[model samples]
Target: MALSPEDVIKKSFSATHLRRGYDETQVDDFLDEVVVELRRLVSENDGLRTDLEDCRASRGVASGQGAAAPAAQGERHEDAEDTQELEALRRQLAECQEARAAAERRAEEAQERVGAAERERDEARSSLEAASAGAAVGASAAGGDGEDPSSIISLAQRLHDQHVAEGESTRARLIEEGDTYRTTVVAEADERSAELQRTGQETHDRLVAEGQATHDELVQTGQSRHDELVQTGQSRHDELVSTGEQTRDRLVAEGQASHDQMISEAEQQRSTVLEDLHGQESALSATIGGLQSQERDLRERLRAFLSDQMERLDGSRPTS
Candidate 1:
């Protein structure tokens, strides 16, 4: 029976598995290559079929013309050429069919090989399992050879105890390391806090001193200017008392406007400083949260490692 393209591809994949010992990836690659070749063959076959059809149509046209003109030399020559071309196409088609058949046969053989290999692999696995079970039974029988089972059990218990003790030691060591890390973190946190506090205190003291100096300078300037103005105005006070009152009113108005401007500027500066401080605090909080998360992850990893070690130790422990 002729195999379909899909069957051929499947057989090819199976063969690859048989030859290469059940490599899925290799089988897939082989199938892909087979598909590419199959597609090429299909295209060629279609082209050949089309060529054959054209040849047959030409032969039919020649035969009709030959029937119309029984002795026409030109018609006879044309008939001969058409016959030759048709023969050539038939031959080519036959070759393509033979090639396809051979490919299918090879694919089938590969599939059989793969099936055989799989069966052998399964048999080997079964043999191994049986052997292992037999060994366990033999070991059990040997244990029942008039020997004191309790003595054997006791020795096993001692070995298991020793293993457990070793694990405990390891766990104790890890705990110590964890404790050391915790202590280090605490110390760093304390140091950072102290540094921040000291820096804040120094900044506050410097700002206070600067403010006091500025205030003193302002007060002295105001007092000196007031005295000068009074001394200068005393002589002219009698002549220009109303003028002096008008000027004083203007100065008071200007000072009030300046004071209001200064107050608004100070309020804006304070708001900006508060926003900056808030941003810094938020950043620090995020940093602390990240550190805490990292610490938690580290602890989890350490625990997982310890658990894995414990499991290994338990598996290796002697059974009572």
Candidate 2:
């Protein structure tokens, strides 16, 4: 496996059987370099990620408003964006799941390492116990050989000190390893979460701005179109009304002329009929007067003739 800064910093060596472990100055110098490199890499990666996210956000916004779009087209664009967002969410979720899985694997590996370390510690403890028992037995044997009691006690003390020092070193190493792994895991997770949050926020802001821009554009276009339609309709209505007025005026004038002609013709016919009646009445009256006069003259003649006939009869016949 690749060694990270934490691993390098936390690396430990077993207590030497004959000499001290690794040189502390050399180890510290190497760890410092590793830590600086790790920091530089992390900073560079974070910067690159931020730049990439910003570029993507900018491109998405530019593409969204690159052309004049209708409302339906804009809705389709929104749906497409929603779909893309859902896909991105799914991808992010998958990445999170993968990261979680990786963390779990790391946790398992860490557990294994801890178990191994614990086992090693237990073995070390057992070895120390065994060594103490051996030293006691040796001291007892030395005492049986008539050795000095002070020397035996001093050997036992030396053995105890060595075992204690070894145990302390092993414990410290284990603690440092655990802390390093924990810090690395937690730092990585926090960094990833922060990056995701920042990217999501940027994307959201860009999308909102683009949507607002599109909405304003559509509203303006619709307003202008409505005004144009209204103007056109008003114009058409005015033209129709003017045409209707002209037709009405023409029909009214024609009707008036026809009415006047009919009235004049009727007046002329009435005058002619009245004059004919008057002339007929006058002729009848004249004929009636003449007939009356003739009747009177005939009556007078008849009376005279009757009288003459009577005289003649008187003359011709005997008087009666």
Best by TM-score: 2
Cα-based TM-score, every candidate: 0.26, 0.36
Candidate 2: lDDT of 175?
A: 62
Tens-place lDDT per residue, model 1, 1-320, is: 75346776757322321122234797578567756755765675565455445443332322333553553455457556655655655565455556545545654555555456556555655555565555555656777676655555555556555554555555456555545654555565456556555655665575567557645654564455445444544544454556546756975896688678767766777788789999999999999999999999999999999999999999999999
Clashing pairs in 1: none
Query: Which window of 10 residues has the lowest lDDT sum in candidate 2?
Result: 55-64
Q: After best superposition, candidate 2 residue 53: deviation in angstroms?
A: 43
List the global CA lDDT of all models: 0.59, 0.68
- lDDT by residue (tens digit), candidate 2, 1-320: 75466776777766532322345797578569757766665575565455445443432222344454465576778868866985796577568657856776776676677667667767766776776677667777788777776665577667666766766676667667766776777677667767777777777787778778866755665555555545655665587568657866975896688678767766777788789989999999999999999999999999999999999998998655
User: Where does the lowest 10-residue lDDT sum fall in candidate 1?
Assistant: 12-21
